[model samples]
Target: MSSERAAVSALFLLNGLLVGGWSPRIPALMERLGIAESRAGLLVLCLGLGSITVMPLFGAMTARAGSRSAVWLAAWLTAPSLLWISLAPGFWSVAAAVFLFGGTMGGMDVAMNANAVAVERSRARAIMSSCHGFWSLGGVIGAGLGGIVLELAGELGQGLAVTAVFAAGLVWAGPRLLRDPPAPDQPRAPLRLPRSPLPFLLGIVALASMIPEGAILDWAAVYLQKEMGAPLSVAGWGFAGCAATMAVLRFAGDGLRNRFGAVRTMRISALTAMSGLAVAGFAPSAGVAIAGFALAGIGIANLMPIALSAAGNLPGMAAGVGLSVVTMMGYSGILLAPAAIGWLAESFSLGAIYLGLALLLLVPLAMSRLAAAADFGSDTAP
Candidate 1:
């Protein structure tokens, strides 16, 4: 409702648009590059690698320059880099382009989230979930528009170029609508990684949550199409259902957390994740799998945002630095999920991966108490 809220929401949308716009076209990109499926997977890994490597550095930069300047710089870097990656002429070039693109995305992610934390603190209540809701909405828009562009123009490059332009336009308009943080010239303590173990606990919770989330994103369609004999056209419904549910629920997450508190929310959500993935893993029909994926989306939707909020607000640390550490660890889980699942799929089954990740969600369930205590510092968990 505030200008800072509007600006931060816009940036969240921009990030989602850029990332989702390119995602639907990945198969085409690999085909263009004459790369095998395995190699394409590796290239995706490179993107995550780039993001993880640079997140902490960007966090420090955000600390020094304030999230305002850091976000603007990220916008500038992201647009052109996305365009370049879309038009890459070869596999290696695509790899390099995606690395840069991922770095900028990572930078934007930290800066924008840091900004969101500031905005939330200014409001003195919960709003992070709503901010993330806008991101989910943007992903829906980007994916739908990207799919349309593919149909109309028959070139992923053109769609991505258009997305890049839109992202740049948003960047140009952002400062006008958004409130700025303190000036970069303001004297502040230099950024440092957290020394306390609390952030690590938060990061572990985030890592556990992200593995299943990423697995659903990267493999849901594959599981439906290949394992269940669903039509290729319909296989995407698994992810679509998940995304739709996630969007809706995240908009409501703050209210739930406010009413029930983080610990109970975490516990219920993790149990939902476990059940949903288990259902999907053992599903006999594509419809059931899609439904399961939707449930899983509901479960996983708010955990990352909640973890991030907890991280940024951790006592006795700079917000940006604390956020970056958790983000890096979470991204590691995301990066590991797809590649590790793929490897396991060679010998085991995608269903096995789903079930494995489902079991892993318990780690967060176990850690939810820690998250509650760290953030609220109360026995509000039960």
Candidate 2:
């Protein structure tokens, strides 16, 4: 169990670091290509599109191959894709690279969570939140490192160089991950699409939770720099701070979920995220706004993990299939976030965009009860 846990944890950490490596450098990418917020969003959207395209297929493949083979294959592809993002010279080139990056990420995301789900069930306890906590910790470190690189050599040089190192590390660590628990030694039917609305309901919860979180990851620094007039070095702190808070909360989330149940846990989280986004939008200074982001981080921390856990445990659905569906939807929110926020920014202030996102939190707040109310463990066949 300990070895398996460590392997999954490593994958989570690598995924977070590879992805987080890009967040703090968004402004640099924009400046280098001389693109507007909206255009940058279109490029980012390609990444999301690629993920959406690949996730369901990857999920199906995970069902057939199990997670161990899927994890190694995805990790190999993801590492090079990160390096691709670092070195791309033009807008189209960057966009193309990121599309591949997102595709590989989709595969990794589903496999790792499916692996975690298997581990959790085998152990007969709660560990999903803590597993996600490692991802947040990696995010915090990666964002901080990117900020430092940005301050020194800017995006194309130091940022790319450092990220390449992290990507290489992921390749090295890929083989250490544990295999998915074995299937029953009996022939089974091939994988199929999940027909249950419960997964969709959980996916909606995931999608809503991801919107604010995605906005923070992609746009927080730009907000700090453009709206709040902060320097690049300091701009990344909002996300770093948010990731830090998320790491802490996620580390503690399992206990809270067990004690209070998913419904109450999600309710509190949504409200907290709402309050934080509202405060950040209205904040008077960069520091205050970062505080709000941190607050929002605490609010948004455990949502995806809880949603994925619920989906994986749904009785008849293949764990990978259910997790991939929710992940694809959740990542769609991430894919949409930049463009939506950018378009809204054109019509309104970034502050207004964030405030609007706060209101959007209500959907998840209302729907969170479905996870608790539904019988996730029913014996329905897939």
Candidate 3:
């Protein structure tokens, strides 16, 4: 790899690590502050709010600031938010921190994907999944280490302090690895509405596919604990298992695509997901349910990366536009679905909510063939 490619890849790796490290510490923060569980769940909304509200603006930002500058800003902002999360005492202060965290993460996500799209063009190959693979590895390491830190110190502030240091170090290294960005390829103008109908529809597909992942993140533990009688420690492993499977599958997806083609790969993945969720909702035993979650992970592994790869390859549109739309929709599922799941869980059984996630994914599964055939940037199906 070129030094620039190496540099950007390193940044992607670090991004995954930091995001992973932050997750396990969240419960400690909630306990430290005496916040209610529902309130804490609501706080997650702020992060999504930060990410979602500003996403469409990113293509414009890329035009104005260049991708590297945008990444630098995110790195600089992210550390302080981690620090704030550690220090904040009341609800609103922490809420502000969550908002900033989400916003910074949002910008970083868009910028990194933009960088990947650009870098892939320069390389003339599909390697986006590899970058995301590192992200999955980072999450694994971060979550594991965060568990250790929480156990050792029982202080969320200390954990954030550590995160801030690592984040700063990554930021310092970010500028070194950045590739020279292209000249502004589009005119700077009003952020007009998205012109492409297909990107928008694909975005819908992305959103529907992502809801199951969100459920695994936010509600898996609850279902395990409330419904299955698992201990707190074991309950978390529900999501951990799913994430681990996703990381591995995603890391291997490039090869999978190379072997099977994106379309067949997506169809197989969707089938795996649908079956996984069905098994998960009806899992009579804890072990069975966890397996189902892992299956879902394996199924979900490549959809986004493949979708983004396709979008980036679209003939008439800028890769940035296709990516931004697809990304926003995917993130919307992450941002918007947990609460809806919670409502369903309250009104119906947790099983019903999870099963609903499975049902929703069926739409994309049925349409996966359509998604495969549409001109997304390559001759490959799906």
| TM-score for each predicted model, relative to the true structure | 0.89, 0.93, 0.87
Q: Identify the runs in model 1 with alpha carbons over 4 angstroms from their true place.
A: 34-36, 144-148, 155-158, 161-165, 176-191, 229-233, 373-382
Local distance difference test scores for all models: 0.73, 0.80, 0.69
TM-score of 1: 0.89
**Candidate 2 on 109-155: residue-level lDDT in tens?**
88888888877776767778888888888888777677787778765
TM-score winner: 2
Residue 63 in model 3: lDDT: 48
Q: After superposition, how far is residue 45 of candidate 3 from its true place, in Å?
A: 1.8
Residue pairs with clashing backbones, model 1: none
Better of 1 and 2 by TM-score: 2
Which 10-residue window in model 2 sums to the lowest lDDT?
373-382
What is residue 353's positional error in candidate 3, in angstroms? Answer: 1.9
In the range 1-382, model 3's lDDT, one tens digit per residue, is: 7766666666666666665555554455556677644665677677678878777677557645667776666666665566667677788888888787777777777777777767766666556777777666666565545556556665564456556656666756686755535335555555665686877777877788777877776677667767898755566566666767778898788777766777777788888888888888999977888899888888887777777776666666665667778888887787667756655665677676777778787767766654552223333332
